[model samples]
Target: MVFDIGIVSNKKILLVDDEEDIVNLLETVLRKEGFKNIIKAKNGIESIELCKREKPDLIVLDIMLPDIDGFLVCQEIRKFSTSPILFLSAKDEETDKILGLGIGGDDYVTKPFSPKEVAYRIKAYFRRHQIGSGKQTSYSIGNLSINEETGEVYKNRNHVILTAKEFQLLLMFCKNPNRILSKNLLYEAIWKEDYLSNENTVMVHIRHLREKIEDTPSKPKFIRTVRGLGYKLVTQENI
Candidate 1:
């Protein structure tokens, strides 16, 4: 996919991996793809420090690092920044994928991946952010309010912090209220990938979103499961 080079060049990208060769290869590819402001970190501690200092627009992280694993690094980073994190790891286990996404990762690309594909994914994420930013709409359902322009969410006038993916999920529901969103549809839409019958990814994110926005996640009032159908965000009128 061709990206607007002028826009892409300005976004700062952080590449974190203990392997020197992997980091170099990714940096080369990203630079070739018009990403100019690339930062490199070889370990989890350095990655964390750079993340705090640089405040990158996105991060490509590897799970197995020298100081701490990528999962812990991701947890720490999520406490402050909502920048998109793409996990690049050799661990292809389903549990690891779930854990990565559950802890606040936006995408997971296993090792032995194509550099061009990774570059394309990064471009796609930036494109999504651009499109999302162009929106100035705000919606309020019950006590929850979302400002798409600022990417801010509020619950009962109290500020609610959300991961980037979680906020996108809520925004998707808010856009299509009272409509059933099947797991496959949601997986395709939010993950920006084909649905591989991996329902857990969507389920985990939805559970997390409920925890943040619902009065009682156990008996969710807004995002309700339609059992065999899928899930729906119940509007105020429906409630």
Candidate 2:
């Protein structure tokens, strides 16, 4: 898990948490990992303001804030930036995790989490972005078109806004058109972690992705369920 210090030092990270100890711990770990440009916010308002002003590359957000919860903050931020957001919340409930991911979070880590693990997650995200870059490619299926180079998605020529994770999911599907993708395969591929009965996590992300790319999520025309198997993206050839 060695990262390029020069690259890591240049990437700005925003940490939003009212808890001083939590913020300090994350900052310490990130700094030790060679991330030099780090910003901190104590409330949702400050976080939003910092996000606009600083334009961070990634954000570590907390659910419980002084004013406006992290969910609302994420919604507001989504209006402007597609920067990856990782939720760091004390609530470990499945519902909270689903809501966080559905709203736009790229990852979620419950409180009492290891500082080192959080650092590693941040590095993993940056690494994925680096690997995904340098590819000047575009794919089109039906009315859906994706530009991998620009990370832009369009449906019937209308621009579509997608969360980071959602974009990755659709890109994966596009690369494997007409092929059924199992939940375990997707979870491991996108999350970069072993699957541990995290079907709901993959399901929620796919549902959100479908809402953006499908004409009707309830009766999806593109990304369809394979009943007992998995999900597949239907291309023009398949259609």
Candidate 3:
């Protein structure tokens, strides 16, 4: 299967893995898919340094590195950059996937995986970002107003900063006010993939999301838990 995702063709990609063969293979595959500016790193420390130096558009990171592991690398990168991160790991456990996503990874691929799938995922990230760029759509409930195209949230007339994922999640809720959105639905819509059995993946992101937009994160007003079902967003006018 070939993807001609031109929006990501010229984008820079950073590949981090201890294995030389995996790095070589991914580089070749990504290049074949039209990605030109590709860089490689062998350890977590080097990867971090490269991220700071290169500021690549996308990152393909291995979970286990020779020095600091990919999770820490992700954590450190999130501090300075919001570039989309894809985790490549040999461990296929649910806990690992949850941990990776919880820390702000955009996607996770278990090892013995297809390189073409990884390339497609990278293209998907760029496509999503393009969709989010430079448009105007408004969602206002009480004092909270979100501008989807601009990726801005104003709470109580004050600006709020959110991660890329959080903004998308909130936009999903805003578009479907008062509708019950199940975890599976939310996962597929936002992540653009099938829902794995990791409930905490969505849960943690929602928790972090509430912390930013809710008056009281502990007792939320806008995004409400639906007890045994899922989650819904409520507006004062709707009530």
Candidate 4:
């Protein structure tokens, strides 16, 4: 059976790491996965400049770059683009992961991760972002409007800019309204893998998503936490 993998089928990827071996390995893996345009950068400065010049679809960045570090790199890139960023780091601490995600990163992978796993995560990101393509469906909750066909969200008639992951989370909530979606379920569905103790990862993304879509993120109405259970999107029918 043939399938159409939109958006990502011909994405240009930017791979940034100081280690040549890691870059080579990821390059090989992405190539085998059928990615055509892959660009490489060795240090933080080069990565930043290359990102501006190339404007790749996604970026795989290492945190321990020789110059400025991946966190700083992500901050810089966010100034110009909202391209999806996946951090590659040896820092596996929960704080590190939270900090990375807090700083506009779409995802993070600790060091010693399977190259295949990284490839899969990237593919999942692309898949979720492409879910709305070729569809004219729109969903509304309160004052917010989501146009799936154009991949756009609006609050009070103003456009809301969201990272790719945030948009995906919102879409998921729209599709499964009134159901308590556990963190593990969300992680697996969106990231295409089993949850690996990344609960805080989901929290960070959810918080960000709420901030964009809610009148008051601190007292969110659209996305409500079920405490011990998980989260659910409460539309007008449930309200």
| Candidate structures ordered by lDDT, highest first | 1, 2, 3, 4
Model 4 TM-score, all chains together: 0.82
Report the C-alpha lDDT of model 1 over 1-239, residue by residue, as the tens digit: 34466889999999999889988999999999999999999999999999999999999999999889999999999888888899999978999999999988989999899999999999988877775336589999999999988889999999887888999999999999999999999988888889987899999999988988999999998999999989999986542
Give me the runs in candidate 1 sitting further than 4 Å from their true place. Answer: 1-3, 132-135, 237-239
lDDT of 1 at 113: 96
Model 1 vs. true fold: TM: 0.93
- Local distance difference test scores for all models: 0.91, 0.90, 0.85, 0.85
Q: Estimate each model's TM-score.
A: 0.93, 0.93, 0.84, 0.82
> Positional deviation of 1 in candidate 2, in angstroms?
11
Candidate 3 regions with alpha-carbon error over 4 angstroms: 1-4, 132-134, 140-145, 152-161, 196-198, 237-239
The digit string of per-residue lDDT tens for model 2 on 12-123 reads 9999999999899999999999999999999999999999999999999999999999999999999888899999888889999989998899999988899999999998
Per-residue CA lDDT of candidate 4, range 4-90, in tens?
A: 454555899999998999999999998888787899999989988998898998999999999898999998987677789999989
Q: Which of 2 and 4 is the better model by lDDT?
A: 2
Stretches of candidate 4 exceeding 4 Å from the true structure: 1-9, 113-116, 127-133, 237-239
The TM-score of candidate 2 is 0.93
The superposed Cα distance between candidate 3 and the true structure at residue 140, in angstroms, equals 4.2
Clashes of each: 0, 0, 0, 0
Cα-based lDDT at residue 170, candidate 1: 93
* Residue 135, candidate 3: C-alpha displacement in angstroms: 3.2
